[model samples]
Target: MLSTVSPRVADPNVRTALVETAARLLAEQEGLTIRRLAHEVGTSTMAVYTHFGSMEDLRRAVRLEGFARLAAHLDAVERSRDPVADLSALGWAYCFNALANPNLYRVMFLEAPIDAEEAESGGATFAPVVAAVQRCIDAGRFTSCDAWSLAVQTWTMVHGMVGVVLAGVFGPDEMLGHLSTMTVSLYVGNGDSRAAAVRSLARARRRMEPHAPIKRSDGAAEFERPRIQNAAP
Candidate 1:
């Protein structure tokens, strides 16, 4: 039911207009100032002040909205017995959120004026990820009883790569390639290598190369995988 519903946005509302305008303006040059944002949204600057109290407040709202959308995405994933796959999916979901909304994601993290409490509270947005890691621990698919730590570590791993790739410093293919092995390392230290997580991540599984259909060392499982071509340079 959560997935079935979109974020409850008040249609044609002044607050949404101002905040949404702020996010878009951030993506373009010479648009962040309140005067330009108001003109672009066909409203007076007073509306922005009235709606958000101040520019800093508007920035914080935009940042939180980005996390809110990501929360919607993580909530949408259907729970299954394949804990590794779900984890992989969440990583991809994290990346997708960044890639699809580069401007919003950037403000949510790099530019937002939120305080330490707001920053710490951002962890709650990833509760679904923590729950998935817990599921892996419960199913004995992963080691380490501290799912919270694993979840935070994994979130850090994925988000770091997302930031790097978006900055154009890292190629998409190279970053995505590292994602599997790096995430696998964490889980391996916890239990079995989660390269098998890739199989369920069709495109990523293919991107893993000749190593696709990774076999368990115990010969307990050999998963056939789907293929994917990474983004071209």
Candidate 2:
């Protein structure tokens, strides 16, 4: 005889379990609706709303989590000693992150609506890539282009390659190594002159940072937030 597990125990752990179950189902199943998700997780729609606000909010949270994870991968890539190699590693990390979490990646990069104004305002979300590019500049590895411009150019190259690979425009085996080399070469270049602007911008950002605090919260000490210029294209 199979034992039955009742979900309606009046326990906080039960409620937490329900929310996690629902979140997992959402990630696994694309286009999941609140009602369907509620049923699968053995909870009510009200429970989902209580935990996550709205369906849109839940989606946003999921995408935000994905971006945070991707950011961590990029961060690790940036920590490498070799600047050129770090950039290449970052490109590889981007592709790997997207491929590993396709649905989450779509929600993070493709489906999430990015505000043009927020992007133009140089929001916090774009800081990691900007910081990475700035490092290359400071090291005299790249030309001194503005951080924003270099960030956009470098990001575009990586994003475009990922898009092509995901869209099945190229076979998996054919593009991986070739694209990685090509992307690194494209940005760092055959000569050092191309990166002059990059170095200058990095220096400028470092100098300017002391004057501007990016965000403030109630009763919290003021701190400088890294400025990430809009590179979303």
lDDT top scorer: 1
TM-score of each: 0.73, 0.61
Q: Residue 73's C-alpha lDDT in candidate 1?
A: 61
Q: Which stretches of candidate 2 lie over 4 Å from their true place?
A: 1-31, 40-43, 115-125, 188-190, 193-233
How high a TM-score does candidate 2 get? 0.61
Best prediction by TM-score: 1
How many residue pairs clash in each candidate at the backbone level? 1, 13
- lDDT of candidates 1 onward, in order: 0.68, 0.56
Residue lDDT tens for model 2, 150-190? 77777777678767865768643344545644554556563
lDDT of 1 by residue, 1-233 (tens): 35676644433487777776788777544458889888988988777776677777778888878878677666656666677777777776676567656777777887746687567557767788888888888888776558888888998999899889878887646666677667666667877654544454544333333322223566322334424244211
Candidate 2's displacement at residue 63, Å, is 1.9
Q: How well does model 2 score by local distance difference test?
A: 0.56
